[model samples]
Target: MTCFPVVCEVESVMLEMQDPKTGVKSQPQRLVITTIPHAITGEDIVAWLTNCYSIEAEEAWALGTMLVAFGYIYPLQDHKRLVIKPDASLYRFQTPYFWPAQQWPVEDTDYAIYLAKRNIRKKGTLELYEQVQYNSLHKWMNHKWDFIVMQAKEQYRAGKERKKPDRVVFDCQERAYWVVHRPPPGTVSAMDYGLERMVDPNTEELLFSCLFSLFSSLVKYSVTYNKHDPFLAPCLPSNPWVTDDVTYWLLNMANVEIPTKMRVERWTFSFGELLSDPRGRDDFRLFLKKEFSGENLAFWEACEDLKWGTAATMNDKAQQVYKTFLTRGAPRWINIDGKTMEVTVKGLKHPHRYVLDAAQTHIFMLMKKDSFGRYLKSPVFKDTQKRAILTTVENAQSKMGIIILKRRPSISPIIVRQLEQEERARMATSGPVDITQVMSKLSNKGKEVPPSKK
Candidate 1:
């Protein structure tokens, strides 16, 4: 799998932060319970980021929090909150082995082993989340519970031999890693790639209901789109491939002045389908104009252009979008919620292609929910539907005579050469042949054959 670019960049920054001479100063720091060696305060981390990148303190703090959240830097004291405190709270650069760029699979067996070791150390005093996971894993891996305990015991014994400071630091490092990976329930994990399930799979009833719902949705979708699917339904007029007619292609051109009845029918299938077709979007734009909310569609289209357009003009286009639609008192202002506005405005300060995503999504949902439904009911759609062209086989045949299905045959040169050689041999053999020559040829064939085995 391809690695995320941010992960690679974070790893590089981490390497610079680990430089002995130019890195954040570290020394033995006393925690509430113990003294951890080579620990740096959270203030030092934020300051180092600000000075190194020449950014504002807020941006530096955000970057530092990202580093901590991604498991590159782990807090030595407050392992629960993974953010730079901008104070004297102790933190440390995580060992490279535990960095997320390693792409290690956070497995249950490894977590079980760690929990078992912690159980032994704390004497059954693991935290609430850890305790819950331990019980679940125990039930799941009951067959190999004994083996897990044995491995955990061996690891704990080995850890006992390490120096006091080293052991404490390692313990804190491992704990921080797990806290990021298996965060308390209800909290979003930074390591999550958005594919995590929302419902528990172990509940049979819920799982069956989810499966049934998904199957129902599939059936409904197939039924709704059955006629629109070209492979499932015959193309109007005639299939271009089979009939060798270009009329179908001409009629279905993306920006055709007037779409066919079938194409207009497809627009009602979904909002996405309507927006995907140029003609449909034009019709939607017309409806939005009548409603005085055309800026929403304009902003959505600008965002799409920014996302897919050339990278060289990305920053300029982002600025243009902000000035045109997002800025207060702008000509074409779009309405979005305050929270989304804050996020979009803050992200625009360090603008990339997706800086306007939150606002764009908010507008897209607004249009989809409110404007899209109205557009279907509005006379604009009905007018377009009424004016849509209807082409039939008879009309096509009358306009452009019966399309002859031409079959063009292609022959390989090698086959032609082989046939030529066979013909030459046939011509040579067509004439009378000498019996002595035939005998000599048979003798040659016999000589060419290998001697028979004994």
Candidate 2:
């Protein structure tokens, strides 16, 4: 089966603290976590978010903006009252991003909504706890988050089993924070990247030291982003780098940190680096002027386009410059067939020949699941992992428990890995249209998928 890893960026930082607490300045720490099946997705997560956040339209907007301003992404939520345990992290991350909480399988969503509608008559549809179906589902739903507790009580008949009866206490009310607290505007601290700031010592003086270090760590023969190589990967804490094994491989990789003296002196990525900010960032745009003729016009243009945090793509020219520097000290035009998603590796070839350390990769996947939760859907993976994911999925699905393939497999993980280094000589390069969907198909090949053609 033809296959490769599903690599993409996932949101890492979350907004929790407000006002005096000032949530973490926020840094993107590289991590990996397990992908959960879709079974846990439901309204409990949604209800918790509503319970946690301010239901006021402006209140939610200010809250969401506070998060985005600190350099993490958050979405808008509509204002409504009567939310249940809103402090839940699942709801905090998913709600603003357009994930529908009510669509979740949890009946608590209906109950929560019922509680929110102040206009509903008390004895009508709004009368909660009386509905049979709602009560049943709510009871089951509540158990999902219920903590296991053991309690012991003393009995009058001493000496037998310590004369105590074990009892369990349900402290749901204490842990379930039903009330939402709305602080003033910019409730969360407008701090710098926390995780990086802790490590860098001078996160502000330097621009992207952590980022440069990470990219630098793996690139031995090359310099910057390789459009074909996974080295120049999408930025985020988890799956920052792409992988070939949809099961374990990843695309996680970036960060900010104290500017090294060298970075402070030479590579400071100031607001001026790509912006029109009066502090001088806008000057980077001078290359676009008719009179400017000192350096690379196209390269400089790319930098300017992304000055306001637009984001980076693998094949951009500046990254090409950096990658070119890393490889053979220069970039060269390689033969490429975009349609085929293939390219020839000359001296400047990049697709980072980097793979996570086995233990590190494993740890990273676990962490990724913590953030994206149920959105992730792969299993454990290794650089040596090479079952074409789909083949495994297909094998599991074969009605006879056996499926024949057009090609016999005989490559070692090591050999398969080395081949990944081969610069395909194709004049074109094209990846699967929908990498995630392709991954799902590969993982569930012949297995049972309600939506699958099988």
Candidate 3:
């Protein structure tokens, strides 16, 4: 189990109290028999609480006492009574490890071990309550009583090596922790949640039924909308991100003149989908107007505007909405139950953005259950469905034609430059040509001068 909210809040206060400068003053206060280091007086604790929270002395004292009862601060002198004295009674902040917010279970085994350890140190001179518990636990755990005693002996021996003051402080801290957790009989335990401790035999069956219902609902919803999910199902024509074809987006624009077959079909998924899409809302609004119940949609739209509109215009818009749709004999008045009307009117006395939320929800359900189903079966929906554009294979092929060209990789510039240099070197190595001989050969191209030349 987690710590209660009150325990968590007290832990934060305790943290602030432990601060060096602003927290309660501490010193080596000498108790009647022992000198305890860094112990705070009760007066200082109450004063600190008053100053920190700006509360009255009485309230601060109550808060301090509560902290003590919860084991955040432990009294050194009077360990039996767990309350702030508002005087010079020495108290110390309990270690964070022992704070109630740590959610440590107050188990009998642990308490038995603590009592056994205390009995060993005090030579069996345990307090009356501790002795009673010790005896009971000893008898109940008779099988493991020897092991418990052996563990207590080890802990007692380890404490002997610590300094006298440190050992005394630790023993007091441990005693205080047990006293708070296992309080005397007839005293209420702060940790107890009465009636919650009882277990119901049918709880497991109820839990399994709830889990099955939740799982079945989730599976049904996913299956119903699986084909409409953009990630799971491909967009028709093509996905713009992959093919750079924007026809899909154009066909599904929020207020498109004509919605696609798939877009029109999505309005049947849920009432929320119809309201979310501008085109779908327009179709629904038209149907409502034909039924002479358009005021419901208008009122719902006004509420949505008020919800998302700027804060500066919130009150003015709220007043306008109330006067137009909610007031007696208003032009666009919508029907709502008497209780919802009373709540809305009372809230409008000092209007906020959500003043019409109850009425809006009422009108929404009215339209969804009555008008929405009729609209789906009426001529309006069927006409739209018939006019809804379908993406054909030929249209997609035509749009994809521009993207079908095959591209060849070009030669590198560095390779081209190297080839040019090699051609120039070959021409240079062949040396210069005889211009006169080259001209004569060109002039006597068809003449046979090979024999004379040889």
Candidate 4:
């Protein structure tokens, strides 16, 4: 079951990242970042993490996503440290492609040998996850219990003091994580481009991240650990996603099955497409004959374990022409996020995240951020919620207090009319009449005074 606390935590972390605060304990967030050409550019993700994590963008690489990507991948992790592969007893990979030992290294065969040796040395077996900080076992269950204790303390204190919590919690037992950018309070929908809208919190990370803003006010957080336990709190039926802990909350996603026969034939592409152009071809038959119009090994070799459902159509002029030209030349096309583009790898939903190196299987990596999760320029700015707060310092243009006119001032037309009537009554009678008023009965005081004899 997907933990609501975990989902909320991930969402909160996302919120904290947009506007970070310092000097106080707020919340910690785990970001799940994904992109094309995964290893080539960590700039966008790194810059983001450094901003929120309050570390130098360069230093941000020391933690979380980047850490996992660089240190935990097969060959590097395998070579640097002797470790056993996670076994079948506790938590197991559904497919051979996902096995820890198989996908972790740059050099596959050597790493596998190393893993085997380590496992045999440790327990007369080749299991790796048993010796790590977070093994392939039910570590998250214990972690979940610990979280409940902490949350219970916080929840009880919150109830007593009527305190608004600055943090939330959650766990992602399922593989997919979310980027929930909650809008400011009461904003349940996307309007005025507000970033803090509350999302379904139950969507694929792709769907969630697309809808949520890259900037926002609220905090979203996630706990990404691989463990499921029976001790979790009973999840409410109305929200099967787990506002609390839910071990039974089941979600079927990322099943990791191989590609179907039709998908294999239709959705794949070859390197020939990347090397060719379509405009010169006069005839379809001629187009097939011109080049080495066979399956290109360079491109096909890049796609190792990816599998997808179906093929998508090409739309743009360049894409359409390239699509036809490449298809004739032994290439195929695939759709990603609704855009059909030619790919070197065929039959996958997101091939951009896959590198040519077959050993690096984990694609999602997020930037790092600070306790409050702001991605500000200076680490000092992490202390404040709003940017204008920085102005309160010496030589700063910011005014500390918001100048509000005392509630409702006496400046309304209705109030002005009342004051004018009161003034006229106090003045009593007018001494003379002007041309505008002609002759006023109250003004002719000299002729009046029939008097009251008391």
- Against the hidden reference, what TM-scores do the models get? 0.46, 0.13, 0.45, 0.16
Q: Residues 2-65, candidate 2, lDDT per residue (tens digit)?
A: 1111100112223343212433222222112322211111133333233556375444544444
Candidate 2 vs candidate 4: the lDDT winner is 2
**What do the candidate models score in CA lDDT, each in turn?**
0.84, 0.29, 0.83, 0.28
**Top-scoring candidate (lDDT):** 1
Global local distance difference test of model 4: 0.28
Candidate 1 local Cα displacement, residue 432, angstroms: 34
Off by over 4 Å in 1: 1-215, 391-401, 404-454
**Best model per TM-score:** 1
Q: Ten consecutive residues with minimal summed lDDT in candidate 3?
A: 193-202
TM-score, model 1 to reference: 0.46
- In candidate 3, position 421 carries an lDDT of 100
Better of 1 and 4 by TM-score: 1
